[model samples]
Target chain A: MSILINKDTRVICQGITGKVGMFHTKGCLEYGTQMVGGVTPGKGGTTVEGLPVFDTVAEAVEQTGCDATMIFVPPAFTADAILEAVDAGLKTVIAITEGVPALDMVYVYEVVKRTGVNLVGPNCPGVITPEECKIGIMPGYIHKKGPVGVMSRSGTLTYEAVWQLSNLGLGQSTCVGLGGDPIVGTSFIDLFKMYQADDDTEAILMMGEIGGTAEEEAAAFVKQHVTKPVAAFIAGRTAPPGKRMGHAGAIISGGKGTATEKVAALEDAGIEVANGPADMGAALQRAMKRGR
Target chain B: MKVHEYQAKQILRDAGVAVPEGIVAKTPADAAAAFDKLGGSIAVVKAQIHAGGRGKGTLKEHPDQRGVQLVRSREEAEQVAARLIGNTLVTIQTGPEGKVVNQVLVEAGCNIARELYLGIVLDRSAAKPVVMASSEGGVEIEKVAEETPELIFKEHFTPDRGLDDFQVRKLCSKLNLAGASVSSAMRFMKGLCRVYSELDCSMAEINPLVVTADGELMALDAKISFDDNAIFRHPQLKELRDRTEEDPYELRAGDAGLSYVKLEGNIGCLVNGAGLAMSTMDLIKLHGGEPANFLDVGGGANVQQVTEAFRILLDDKNVKAVLVNIFGGIMRCTTIANALLEAYKSVGFNVPLVVRLEGTEVEQGRKIIADSDVDIITAEGLTDAAKKVVAAATGATA
Candidate 1:
């Protein structure tokens, strides 16, 4: 009942033999993600943790029926890799690669919209459906099957919130890293809608940061459509305007995208917001009390 | 990444945008020559920098025709140029450490009937490059936004899909534009788009695209910022970065491939996790002292990276102290400590350095640093390290 990936989701590792790809693929396999195959030209016929490898995405899709593709390719080749995945008709693409060119993301948007495949990130940690499926680099120990739906722009903070949630024994339904690039595959609104429809997800925990209109757009959607109680935490409370804060997509530009603005937007939409970084779990717990 | 006004105008003229005749000057002598080049009585001496505060300051007018009035004379021009040459001149249009000026624009002042701003920049929300037009363009676009929000007109363009005839017509109609000016602006954007696509630009702007009484859409300023990663494609722009005007720490950090942005704070941050880096800064403040800079030598920093990071961090005079918060993760703490000790020996800093190493190899890393005899204060927890830094910097009990 998660938003993106689940038990039945067949996945492909785009740069399977690469360091990041190999590391996360093993973790995903251990977490019970349905790792069907991998794509790395010239590394075809090799097996990583017993998963089949193909030279091309087209071949991998044809042979193994991999539905989701997690890309860990280098920045320069990421665009081509994404185009290839899109061409092969992958319904879900999660990019663990960072620093993909903004212009390249424009192409990703085009390919996703034209092909109707859900593209997750160019610089995100990735999506995790707790114990059902673990994609990307999130520490598998911190997440488990629960009713709370989570989405974040920061990869590490997602881990932080997940650790906190798991500590409370609340677990999670789906935690999607929408990515922290100036432009990304999906917006918060798109993910929120999916979470809203899932009955298994009783509440949503949106982890946002300063920058872009994604959170505001999500708040608007929550106000109009989402029936589930939502709690949120916007990072960069101490960050100055226009600073990168590590994530490429995260910056307070033109004084528009600040923690204050985001928290207010969420609060105005009737969602609960933590005062700062430490109160994320407490905020969600408070929101749940009110929702009933 | 913003190019100077004069430099940007030259690029615009090359892109076929009609621009006013201008020359960059370094001295009042240079200004006189440029003034003569105009074949007119006056010239505009602009303090060319990546920032936008020059207009409000003494940067917008020509030097006095006679004896050097530091505000208007050749000697004054020399003095102004001297002070501004390598320093970042803060401006309104631009923010912070301005675009460093290696050259100055000594131009023939425009005979303006009206001033308008026409800018094309990345629109974060729409995830598209937008062309922003303001009829009230002479003043800062921000002022126009705060006072008269209705004056700003934004027209977005998808880079692959070029602007069409209708958009051009609408832009002209909204601008109340007329004559050859319309065609020229259209040609400029078309060529500009060519440059934007070909050069891989993040933003291309023309502030105060002056509509002369003579009827021309003359480009008064050209400000272009290429995507930093895309700079490799446009090898020529690599020469445009001026480190002289930058925070010494930022320059050194950049050279070392670490993301370090200086702030007016007392606590120094060295965190393994990017998210942890920020959270550490907030927590540092929560414990009562500001963070001096946002420095994250991303996960798994080796000896050279950590040393370079220390060198950069110490360069910040604003950083009264440092708080090394490492949630070891996959990054080896031993490597960071070795680097820290190496940087300390090389830089010979007397400032207090507090290290909080957690996760894998913490004991081994701490033992290495301890063996180095570098006199670094080691903390067992995040809160303990933050308190140590705050006390060291502000002389207050944390």
Candidate 2:
């Protein structure tokens, strides 16, 4: 019943030999995810944390029968890694790499669409379906197994929202970090539709920021097709204009992509908008109450 | 990452767009040369920087033989250039910090009928470059958007597909089609899109495109920003980067290969994950401590990024303390400790450093830093780390 991933998803690690990749792969294994094998370009046949390594994602996929890849390669190579995964016919990919250029991501997007493969992030925190399967750098202990599905573009905002929701006993069925890059592989609309179809997911907590029309488009999408209740928060309401803050997409360009605009759009779609990031959990609770 | 107006236009022109003739100047001599290049009768002398307020300060001039006039100068353009050559121009548009002018753009002034703002960038939701057109061009499209949003039309175009002719014509008509200038604007838009896509730009904008008194659409102002991550591919962009305009610490941090974007804050943020770094920035603000910068050494940071992050924290001069928040995940705390020691070795610090460590080998990480010769303090949790950093910044006893 979980959204994008469950316990049975076969996972392969790209850049499994890298320090960060190896650490997180071990973490995924500790969480009891099916860490089948890994691909490290030149370090084929090596073992990292007891997982077999192959040269390419295709080799790892062919040898291990893994179709889901979590990429931890550096920025310059992440786009290639994504393309490799998609070309290998991977069904789902979660790229843990940040600082990927928008140009690189645009190509990755074209490849994903061309290959019909789903890519999660270029700046995201990765996805975790609570106790079912964890595939990111989030604190596993803070997340609890539950029914609400959380999707966010910003990492800290996502973390803050999840921490608040977890503390309030409103655990997430899956919390997907869509990444905060100006260009991302998945939008809120994509995740919203998935959450809407997951029967185990009762409500949604979507965290958006002041950059891009992703939230606006998602709001428009929800107004038409999304049946489940959505509670959302758009960050940087009071943030200074034109400054990127942290995320590449968090800029207030030419006065558009403001928090006010996103919230207004989300509210107009009949979804409840939280007052701020701090109230996201309670906002979800209220939306759940009203929807029921 | 934003390039100046004349540069954007020149890039547009090089890309085969019909843009007004312009020249870049670095000094009064260069401005005078540019003035001569534009036939010296009438030309626009503007300060070249990364912001949007040349109309206000000594940044703009029309130097003539008489003296320096902001709008009607021929000689005063020299004074404008002289005054701005080695000076800084502070504007609300440039954020809390202002941009330094090492160059000035001198161009043939345009006759105006209509002014508009047009920009192309990656659409946040659609994940493609979206072109935005506004009739209220020059002053601030944000104000235009706030007061009148319908006038703003966003045309989404994929990079691989390039610009659509129909969309370009449609946009030109909205910018107000009267003459063949509609074609000129369309040409400029498409050219800009080409440069945008080819350059791997994060944003490219032309604000206040004036329909000159001569019935010609002219881009009076331009701004261009390249994706910093992509700058490595283009050596020309790397050369164009004015590190002098950035925080010395931030520049140094970048040199250290860390992702650090300076912010207007007092609390220094050091985090492992970019998402966590963002959350730390927000939390710092929520807790009443402005983050000095968004520093993400990225996951699996080693000694170099950690120490560079620390040195960057100290370099902020405004920062009174440092908040090292690392959620180790698979990254061991011991590595964090080694990094702290390494950073301390590279740059000795006197300010308070708060280390918040969690995950595998957490105690080992703590032990490494605690055992280091460098003074290090531990936080009970992230919130506690934040509070401590705030306390240290404000000289409080919390």
Candidate 3:
């Protein structure tokens, strides 16, 4: 009933020989995800973490029949790795690498769209369906399998919300970190549709920061199609204009992408907005009451 | 990541796009020599800064001194350059603090029969590179879009294939370009697109794409900014970065693999993740405190980065308190706690400090901080941390 990934989903790690790749791959394995094999060009026929390593994604997919991939390739080669995965017919490709060039993403976006492949992030904290599967770098212990589906454009912020929900005795159906880049593979609206369709997800929690019209667009989509209870927290309200607050996408630019505008949009859509990060769980509880 | 006007023009000229001949002068003498070398009836001395709207901007030191001024004599060029190169130019884009103009671009003036706006940006909405054209030139494109939407024509092109010839022709026709000007516009638009894609530019704009009396289209003003992520591929473009135009703390943070933006406030923030860092700032403000700066130590930050972050925060004289919030994911809480203790010993914090650690290895991290005799305030949650830091910063009991 979890969206995107579950216990049955077999995963392969791209660039599994790299330091970060090996570390997270073992983490995922320890969390009980089916880490079938990995792809590291020039390191084929070798094994790490008791899993086989292939030269390319196609070889890994063919040998292990892996349905999904977690990419840890360097930013310079991340786009090509995603392309390789898509070309190998992977249904879900999650890129955890950050600093990927926007132009590379542009080309990758076009190809992914043409091929109808679901790409998750290039700078995100990956995805996790608590208890069933862990496919990202998110802490596994803070999660519990339950009714809420969580998604955010941040890494640690997502962990914050998930931890708060867990503390409230609320578990999650799945949590997706959509990355904090100006150009990410997945959007709020895209994940909204999936969370809405998942039977286990009775409510949705979305976290957004300033910069870009994705939040506004997601608000519009939620108002029309989403029937489940929904709550959101938009960060960077205190941010000054024209200053990039850490994230490339988190900025108040051109008199647009302000937190006030995003909050207004979400509230107008009838979604409960959390006053702050600590208030996210209570906000979702309020949303559930309203939905009932 | 933004380049000076003269540098942008040089890039444009190298890419086969027509631009006004310009020389970058670091001193008034160089400017005067540049003006003499151009040997034109009129020349322009434009102050070199990162921001746009320089033409309408004025010097802070001398109110009557404009950033961009037309000079008929070399002596006038020298005077204008002298005023601009050593003073701050306040513009609509630059804040009231403005930016110091260390150089000036002296270019030969041209005869403009008409002016139009042309720009290429990585349009997030369309998820493609878009070329926007408008007949209303020398005006803010945002104003033109807001006031008269139909006046703007756009063509979205993929980075792989670039803008098609037909798209360029359509844009030229939309701008009412005819005869020789049409071909010139084609070369200008296509070359600009090439520059955007090949150079991995985030934004490439020409404020006034001028049509001369002889029906030649030229980029009168150029603004080019490369994507910071892609700069690793272009070492040459990386060299174009003006260190003087940036905040020293921000530059230092960049070198240390941390993301930091200096703000005007009292509470210094060091956090993990950009979103969490911003949220920490928002929470601080909500609790009646202002944040001094936004610093994201980033995922997988090591001991050195944490110490560096502490040093940067302590370096800000406005900071009265420091808050460290970490929600470990790829970064473990224990690693951050260890880093914090390490930083406490190495950097030696004077300001009242509050730490909130959560996520992986939380218990161990808390125990590590609790066992330390480093004089730290520990909070269980983000809200508690914000309230405590604000109270401490304002010298109130929490």
Q: B1-398 in candidate 2: lDDT tens per residue?
A: 65556667777777786577777787788787777667746776677766666576432232221111233565766766777777666665655445667887777766678887888877655667889988777767767777888989889887777778888788777766656776776667777788888888888878776777766666667778888888777777666666666667656776777778777777788886555676667666766787787787865677767776787778777887888887665456788778777787778777787888765577777777666677777886556777778878788324
RMSD of 2: 4.4
Question: Candidate 2 local accuracy as lDDT?
Answer: 0.77
Sort every candidate by lDDT, greatest first: 3, 2, 1
Alpha-carbon runs more than 4 Å astray in model 1 = A42-50, A242-244, B27-31, B36-41, B59-102, B318-321, B327-398
**What is the lDDT, from 0 to 100, of the residue B357 in candidate 3?**
91
Q: Backbone collision count in every prediction?
A: 12, 29, 0
lDDT of 1 by residue, B253-337 (tens): 8778798887888677887656667777877887788998888887657878887887777766767788887755446677777
TM-score of each predicted structure versus truth: 0.89, 0.84, 0.98
lDDT of 2 at B348: 79
State the lDDT of candidate 2 residue by residue for A83-141, as single tens digits.
88888889999998877888777767877877777789977778998887888777677
State the lDDT of candidate 3 residue by residue for B217-269, as single tens digits. Answer: 99999999999999999998877888988888889998999999999999999
* Best TM-score among the predictions, by candidate number: 3
lDDT of residue A15 for candidate 1: 95
lDDT of each: 0.76, 0.77, 0.92
